[model samples]
Target: MPHILLVEDDAALAALIVDYLRAKGYQLSHLSRGDEVLPWLRQQRADLLLLDLMLPGLDGFSVCRLVRGISNLPVLMLTARNQHLDQIDGLESGADDYVVKPVEPRVLLARIQALLRRAQPAPLAELTRGQLHLQRSCRRATLGGQPLELTHSEFELLWLLAEHAGQAVSRDTMLQYLRGIEFDGLDRSADVVVSRLRRKLGDHPKSPEKIKTVWCQGYMLLPEVSA
Candidate 1:
């Protein structure tokens, strides 16, 4: 069962959400105050977080930022403030998504399920190619024994490539795997994402060795599975 940390101030609403989510087979931990969130999260492991914007002390945005700084755990902000700026602020603060107050229990559940699906970790068997080593469960990658700093998207892309190591992954295929949709008019965005990923992985686009660009095709992880 997926564990969720729910931070809400209203006792009645919190109870309702907890009951609904628990019925849906989610293991839930509730905290009414934002001040308690960090400590709770540090002590208990949760797959995702459902946070309310208005809380006693700290506020949800700050909590989201603090969590992002330490871990890439998925966050879904629940707010009564429907302003676009509030939503943007939540996202900028590292929330995966946001929901307005007076939310339908069903919709919240759907969003929670979607975020969990997107945040699923890669399989946890060792994957190595040359000096690159990826440990899926921990979401850690090292190149030549040096730790690699990767964003969530970059990690996912690397994991996908490693899964099919040595095979060419077309841009469309990668987009589908990453975004769950065809690039369509977002081809440039896909290229930009890949370019950023290459930079993070220390793979030069020109004369690349680890992740090779195949002209108009896509990318391939070099087949030398060592290190």
Candidate 2:
């Protein structure tokens, strides 16, 4: 069963969602204030988070940003506001998905299931390809037994690429996986970040043997080069 931590200020709506989701076999824990979420998360783990936009102390956006810094757990934003800007803001703030208010219970459930599916990866404590190794627990990565100094974002991007070694993961998918948000069609930040990672990995863009860019697609770790 997938466990969900839901942060919503509305009592009635939270109860309805909890009951509905429980019936569908999902285990859920509820927090009525945004400020309470991080503390609760410290004591517990959840497969996903159902976050509402309007909250007492910290708003949903702030909560999402903070959570993204510490965890890769999927987040789905729930909001009564129907503005496109709100949706964009939520996504950029690290929400995996956003749903407007008055959503059908069935629709919400389906979305949740989809998010969970996307978030699921092979359960591996550590991932390795060739001379590269990544420790998921510590978020530390090394190449040829030498630590590759990487920022949090770089580590995540490399980890995802390493996890799906030899597969050309799309740019949009990369952004979503590493950033916990959707790609704005025009955003080339993923490319830029990949370039930086490549430099650190000593994979020249011209004749890369470690991480390779699949023309117009995304990136992949060279499976044959795995030492």
Candidate 3:
């Protein structure tokens, strides 16, 4: 069973969520104040987080940002702030997904399921290919045994590519996995991430042999790349 932590000031809503999710076989716990979340997380373990914007202490955005810095815990901001900018801010703060209030219970359940699925990778604790090493639990990666300083998104992209090593991972697939949206053909986020990954991986900037572009397909991480 996946453990879920919820930070919400609304008593009624918190009770509702806890009851509903618990009935669905999830281990649900609620913290009424944002200030208590981080300390609680350090002592306890949870598979995912459900955050609310209106809280007693720190706001949801701040909580999400701080948590992201320390862990790759999937954060889903479930807030009443339905404004367009609020959603953008939540995502930029490192939330895995954002959902507005007045949402159906079934929809909420689906979102939780999706996040848990993404967070739980293969049974392997570490994935290694060629000279690259990735520790899924800690979100750490090393190239030739040297640490590879990576941003959250960059690491995520690398993990996805490494999982599908030797096969082309299309921009649409990457967009959907990373941003929860399909590529618009005009979006260059995937390409930008690739460029950063190549630089960090020391791929030839001019000829790029490690992560190669498959004309019209997408990017492929060669199973064997130089250290």
Residues 95-195, model 2: lDDT tens digits: 99988887689889999999999988857889878788889989888888898899888988888887788899899898888777787889888888889
List model 3 lDDT by residue over 44-100, tens digit each.
999999999878889998999889988999999986645888888899999999778
At residue 59, give the lDDT of candidate 1. Answer: 92
RMSD of each: 14.0, 15.1, 14.8
Name the candidate, 1 or 2, with the larger lDDT value: 2
Q: Where does model 1 exceed 4 Å of error?
A: 123-227
TM-score of each: 0.55, 0.54, 0.54
Worst 10 residues of 1 by lDDT: 185-194
Global CA lDDT of candidate 3, please? 0.91
TM-score of 3: 0.54
Residue pair clashes in candidate 1? 130-226
Q: 109, model 3: CA deviation in Å?
A: 0.3
lDDT of 3 at 160: 94
lDDT of 1 by residue, 35-150 (tens): 89888878889999999988998899999999998899999999774578889999999999988889899889999999999998754687887778888878899887988888
What is residue 138's positional error in candidate 3, in angstroms? 30
